[model samples]
Target: MKVLLHVSHLVQWDIALSNSKNLKAIEAKSKIEIVVNAHAIQLYRELSENLLQQLNELENLNIKVKLCRNALRNNNIEESTLPATVEIVPAGIFEIIKKQEEGYYYVSP
Candidate 1:
């Protein structure tokens, strides 16, 4: 199954990443995609090196983390700050709707 995780709340990236880990544990073979919008990117940028390392592990698990272009612009975050695999989608909400419409389960955390 395809799962779309919408992360909009502000907090440590570890929490979001941890949730992703838990989800993966529950559904070992599920295809998980994450959308980090608004303040979430800001939190990720501020994470400590160790936390960032944990986030890097997500890539090994094949979980794609996307940042909202609108949110990046609104927060004045440079593209260079993001990880290489972090995709920039046009609109996070639209992506969520589109994925849900296409049969991906929507989860917010």
Candidate 2:
């Protein structure tokens, strides 16, 4: 099964990650997508190395991490500043909608 985790709020970062981890742990073949947008993009950038390591661990576990281009523009953040693991999409909401149409279950914290 696949899930699209829509994360728009900075406060939900930890909850989203933890739930993704739990899902990945319980379902070995589960597909996880983490979409970070809005204030969460800045939150992602401001994260410490340790938290980033946790994110890396999720990537290692095959979770796809996405960032929104519009969110970056809104926050005045450069696209080049994002991590190597994150793929920049045109917009977070659009991506989420596409994923939903593609049969990916949506989860939000």
lDDT of 2 by residue, 1-109 (tens): 9999988888888888888889878998998898999888887556578767977888898998899998889888877766787788998999999999999999888
Best by lDDT: 2
Q: What is the C-alpha lDDT of each candidate?
A: 0.80, 0.86
- What TM value does model 2 have? 0.92
Which residue pairs in candidate 1 have backbone atoms (N, alpha carbon, C) closer than 3 angstroms, thus clashing?
A: none
Which residue pairs collide, candidate 2? Answer: none
Score every model by TM-score.
0.85, 0.92
lDDT of 1 by residue, 7-26 (tens): 88776355668777888898
Error in Å for residue 85 of model 1: 2.5
- At residue 47, what lDDT does model 1 achieve? 50
